[model samples]
Target chain A: MLSVLLASGVANGLLYGLVALGVVVLAKAANAFNFSQGDVMALGGFVSYAVIVTMGYGSVAALPIVVIVALFVGVLSYLLLRPLMDAQHAVALLTATIGLSFLVKGTIRLIWGRQGDYFAVPPLVSGPPIILFDGAVIIPLQHLVMSGGAVLMLALFALFFRFTRLGLFMRSVADNPRAARIVGIPTELVLCSAMVLSLVVSAVAGFLLAPATLIFPDMGFSLFLKGFAAAIIGGMMSLPGAVIGGVLLGVTEVLVSGYISSTAQELSAFVLIFVALIFFPRGLFGGRSSRSV
Target chain B: MKLFSQIVGVMLMTTALAVPAFAQDVQGVSDTSIKIGTFGPITGANYAFGRLTMNGLETLFADVNAAGGVNGRTLELVRVDDQCDPAGAIAAVRKLIFDDQVFAIIGGSCSNGVMAAKEDIEQSGIPFVNFAAASNNISAPEIENIFTSMLTSNLESALQAQYLSDLGVKRVAVVAQHDAWGSDRHKTLLPALAEKGIEVAVDEELSMEANDATAQVLRVQGSGAEAVVLLSYPKPASIFLRDAARLGFTSSFIGTSVIPDPVAFDEQVAVPGATDNFVTISPSRYALDSAEAAEWLEKLTTKFPDDEPHTYNLYGITAGQLTVAALEQAGADLTQASFIAALEATSGLETTFAPGPLNCETHQCLQAAAWIKRTPEGKTEVVGLSTLD
Candidate 1:
């Protein structure tokens, strides 16, 4: 049971963390929650699916093309997000993201029509499900894929921020865009890069999620809400916090639904979020950072 | 005041004439245009159900109209997006029946949304054939004006317990949504379980909007149960299955129709990882080998090319087919009474009807009808099908 739970949690958490990363990138870089982050995730999954199925690209061959497509989509989404960034309350940004979410979901409807697609996909992660504790539960090879991708993404993100000049400039802008601008930083470019990175993360999350959940236009709305909840529980601005929140949330949900009422599942999550807000307003592992710096 | 009086007078005249052709039956809705109306959500959380529902309705209408119309009157459908809200449902019904002057109505995606507006539907006086909304309360005690095209959730849960018992699974954990509908399932299922000498190890409730089911998974896993029964919608159902794996809950999972969406199998049902020991019940099955089913599917898909033919897609098409059969029995130059009588006279008529006692004496869906589906090899295969005896 332990092995299976950890395996599933790691995979589920990693996908969620990727979504949270998108939220973190936007929130940290531009102080906004891309409400459409969920739809973007759904869009990434479907786009790759189309590339593989309709365009006849093998899933392995589709990877590079998917990345390029994801980047282009990220740029387009960034351009869309630009106007909303300047709004005073940030609610404008939220609404715009929501609108984009709706639009993308609607567009998916137009494309897929109304039926559930039953597609056959190959095993991305190799090896058998590792069973532990007298074979009580088993962990599948996909867990490795999920774990490796999550750790790799986080490492890449950290490395990019730690040493690269572009990363440093972006960090300065995120920490204080006005100050960075005063120091001759190109704020627009920084924001654009944030959008690009956010979308890339979102696309990978979508690709990972598609294998188990399959592709549906409406799937994004739920993913968006979950990602949003994870971001909120993780302080809405911290990458590590978002990662922790995603895993914590994924694990909590499993325990709750297994033991308690499924109806009370969301109720309990809200209770946890509410309690966290009251006690540790900055979330677990949070520190105060000021854009005014 | 005079204008209001005039409007009332006009309505009265329209009603009177419309009823018996005394003066109000304005349009000749014949072979070129037989108008029907539907209400569904164009916005909100459950909006996808409505959108897909609309697609099915439109496709079926086109199919019916193409096959030489119903009694020589072409089928025409008018739609109003209700956004799946109660207040919105009421307004959509009013607009369709009162304003659009449709002959009949079939528009339900959510039970709560429809149940809230039942009185408004009763008041409408138009024949209402529901394509969705699976609550017995919708048709209980025989409203006469309204009828459903699917099985109620109560029977659905009982059937789940019965099927599990048949499979020799004794101990089970039931996870359900925490709403009136989900609660209704819990209330119905426990008694059904007890009667069958089966014990519920863990009975849990989760919210429809939840993203994970960790706590719920732990309780079910800790309950020492072999199988887990889920009475949930799609969103939580997906989270539950995925999270169940993450929590090391290796118990077999059996879910309601809400989660057996075939597309999810192709998308994220993560079969080998997420779907081992998982099986679910769909409303009915269309085995590729079942001649009637294959013919029906072919006709339906061809007729309504725009709709994705899911389980519910079949429901709408079946009901439409039943109505068509009833209308045919009504003969040309039919009236409302003749149409009702034709439907009442059905004995063993199996025109897209699932296996159930078609007493026709009671307008209720007698017994439950469903088939079990499993993603054994990345395909949603109907392993077995039966109607409750």
Candidate 2:
């Protein structure tokens, strides 16, 4: 029973980790949180559903459309809010992103509100549940796919940051926008690229997690809240810390639910946030920064 | 002297002509149309309850208009989105009454939202005919102006408890949402279960938007219950069933009126053979594909080209039929008071979609329900019917 619980926790954790990873990347590069990450993820899932189910295309065929649409939205938002990003007005940027979340949410509601309550995207691969330990633990194949997808995306992100020039430009701008600008780096382009990459990460997470969670218009807010918590726990600027934090949060939630009660699981996020704030002001991985939103 | 006499005569004739028009001055009634307002969650997760039902109402209105309308007046529907929240419902009801000035309202898709707006409806004295929403408090204790054609929670709870007793289930587990929607049914279900001498093995809460039900499933499985009553909307209910299947927890899963569309629910669960032992209550007697419903299905599909036939539509259709009946009974000279009087006098009004006869004498009109079961092969069956005693 414990093993099954842990497996389920980790599976859910990976999805959260992906969302947190996007948040961290955007916060690092653009120096502003992308509050609409969850909604963007939902849009990705809906687009996949449209391509795969509605248009009679395979999952692979939907990927390019998802990436293109996400990239367009990301770049468009950055361009529109370029002045705020340049001014480094953190509060204004935060409010703008929150408004963007609403815009995306409302657009989704308008397009798909009448279709149905929940939509099920077929799994990437179809197979029976994988049983282990003398049939004591059962893991759904889709959950395994989601975990593997999350890991693969994380590795790719790491490689891109380490081996790509565009990645270095983003990192340099994140470190010191004025210095990078003086040193001939196109800070504006770097910020836009960071936004695109962040949204792409979220879109991939959406496609991978849609089968397990199902697709609904209001599905994003809860996930956004969870991802925000995971991001905060892992140290807001640390990519690896986000992954660890998400897994830890997921495991703790499951353990609390299993041993105590389900109600406790809902409250566990708040409790974890409160404890983290009191004990570790900088989080487990966050660096010292006087700046706050 | 001749000029003064002519002016006085003209004034007297004009006053006489204006008296009749003044006598017929009602807020939402005009010489050629009657305005009716409907409110529900049009833009949220519960859009089906609001939007689909509204479509059914519109279809019924369209048919009536095509057939020359009722008493030579076309029915115009004014829709307001309540988003299934109490404050939103209250504001919607007020807007319908004050701003829209609708003669009668035929809506209430969410239990809590409807209950929240009940006070405002009572104060306004507008004729309110609830299409969906099964909370007993919405209609019981009889608000003179409000009448529900939907089966109230009390009657459904009794029928559910009776079903369990007939199955000889001694122990039962309940997984319910804690919101107003779930609380209305859960409160009534507990007493009904106690009456049947069934012990509650476990009681758990699942949120409406919950994507996972692992903890609840595990706790319910550990309780050794013979059956489980799932007092939740379709989303959380399906998630619970899916998690239960994943955990190999086998039990008779029972559902309330909220899950009327068993076929869609089975698909939503996305697990093969997961709903083999699942049974849900429906206010509609006939299944969506049954011969009796073919006419409605055709009518609905024709009216809303994008929508598939659903039981929620039937709920609105039934309420629309009831409203039309009341309007016809109220006669050509219609007012809010007359409509309420007509609704109160409604007895044995059969809509063909509801399980049995409906009456508004007690304000809680619906008393019968049907059970829908999904076979392992994914076929939905209207297995049985029950009328609460």
Candidate 3:
């Protein structure tokens, strides 16, 4: 039971981490907390559902379509937030994104309202459960894929932030937006790029998680709240903290559920967030410097 | 002065005689049409229950109207979105009563929402025919003007327990939602199972939005139960089934009227053969694609082009049939009181797709349900019938 709970927790936690990663990136690079990150992820999943289910295309075909749609959505989101971004009003930006969240949710509901309560997206790799301990403990193939996808995405982002010119620009902006602007970094363009990158990450997470979560309009707000809790636990501005926080939350939820009760599992994420905020205000990995690493 | 006093006395007598005659006229009834109001969650997570049922009511009304109208009165439906909430249901019912002035109501989809507005409905003295909301309290206490055609939660719970008991399942696992809908059944189910000499090995709570049920599955597997009773909507149930299959925890799964269509449920689970041992209790005897329901399905498809035929729609059609029967029985000099009387007097009323005759002894009309199973080849078959004795 412990092994099964641990495995399940880690797998779910990684997916939540991917959602947090997108949230932390926007919070860092754009100096803005995007409330709609979860909805954006839901949009990605539904778009992929359309590709894979409605259009009768495979998961491979849905990826490019998701990326293209994410690009358009990210750019549009930047354009909508541009004026407020210039003013640098945190509350205004946050408020606007909440509205964006509603708009996105309403749009998704409108499009897929009559389809069903929940739509299934077949796992990327279709096969049986991976047996361990002579079938005493079994891990689903999709869980493994989901975990690997999260790790791979995390690694790819790490490489990009460390090696790419665009990554440098984003880091500079995160350290000090005004300073980066002074150094001839097109601040608006960089922020736009950050939004795009964040959404793409979130969209990819949606595609990976869709098999487990299923596709539904109401899935957004709950996932958003979970991701937000994860981001806060990890420190809102710290990327690595977000991932760690997500895994911690996921594991805690599973363990609590396995050992304690199912009702406690739902409360575990919020409780953890509360404890993290009270004890480690800057998070476990958060540094004194405002810059996110 | 004497002439003026005499004239005023005559005028007062004339006004007093006319008041009773005008007061007898119903609010939504006219010579040419009978306007009925319906409320459900046209939007939100439970829209399938609400929206599709509303569509069914609409289609049924259209069919009735097309058939030369109901006793020279064309049925007009007035729908309001309840948002599947208690407050929303109250507002919707109030709007129907005070604003729309609908003569009678023919729908109530969300259990909690409808239950919330029960007092208001009872107080308003309007005839309310409940379509899909199955909280036992909605009609079991026997409100004079409220009648439910759907099998009440208590009946379904009793039937589920009986079915499990008959299967010789001594130890059973239960996974139910803790919300109003689930609580209504779960509260009754515990005692029902006990009465059947079935021991509840494990009890778990699942939320409406829950995507995973691994921990619950593991716990259920550990319990060594012979069967599992799912007291949730299709989403959580589907997740539980899929997770159960993934973890190789196989057991006989039993569900209630909420999962009406076995074929749709099998598809929703997405795992091949996951629903092999799954059987659900449905109020409708006929499947959506069954030969008996082909004509009604055609009518539903013709009215709502984008929607595929659903059991929820059939529920609404049943409600409409009940309302029209009561209306026809009420006679042309229709009023709220007469409608209530007609509904109360209606017994052994058979309608399209109903599992049993709707006999409103305690305002809970349908007491029987049919067990539905989906074949591996995607065919929904009715295995058997169970009626509460």
> All models, DockQ values?
0.22, 0.39, 0.51
As a whole number from 0 to 100, the lDDT of residue B162 in candidate 2 is 88
Top candidate, metric DockQ? 3
Q: For model 2, what is the alpha-carbon lDDT of residue B259?
A: 83
Best by TM-score: 3
Interface RMS deviation of candidate 2: 2.4
At residue A165, give the lDDT of candidate 3. Answer: 91
Give the better candidate number (2 or 3) by DockQ. Answer: 3
Residue A144 of model 1, lDDT score: 61
Question: Which candidate wins on lDDT?
Answer: 3
For candidate 3, lDDT tens digit of each residue in B1-389? Answer: 67864564454334333433676656887788988999999877677788899999999999899997888999999999998999899889878877887888888988889988886787667789999998888987788889998888999999898878777889999999988779989999999999999999999988887778889998889989999999998889998998888777788999878888889888888887789999999998988888988998998898899876688988998888888888899888887788888888889899988888888767888878889999878988998887776
Cα lDDT tens digits, model 1, A1-293, are 45555665666777777788788887778887776677778777777677776677766765666568668877887888788777484887778877877777787767764334323334455454666677786766666676776778778888988998878888898788889999998888888888888877877777766644445566677776667677778878777888887877766655454444445555655776788778878876567645773
lDDT per residue as tens, model 3, A1-293: 77777777888888788888888888888778777778888988998889988899999899899989889989999999888875458789989999988888889989987677788887677677787888677677777888988899899999999999989888999989889989898877788988888888888888888877567886777887787788888888888998999899999998888788987889888889888877888776676646578
Better of 2 and 3 by lDDT: 3
Question: How would you encode candidate 2's per-residue C-alpha lDDT over A1-293 as one tens digit per residue?
Answer: 67767776787787788888888888888778878889999988998989988898998898889889899998888876777884558889888888888888889888887778788776677666689888887776766777788888889988988889998888787778789999999877888888888888888888887766578887887887788889999898888988887887777787777778776788887798789867778777887668677
TM-score of each prediction: 0.78, 0.87, 0.91
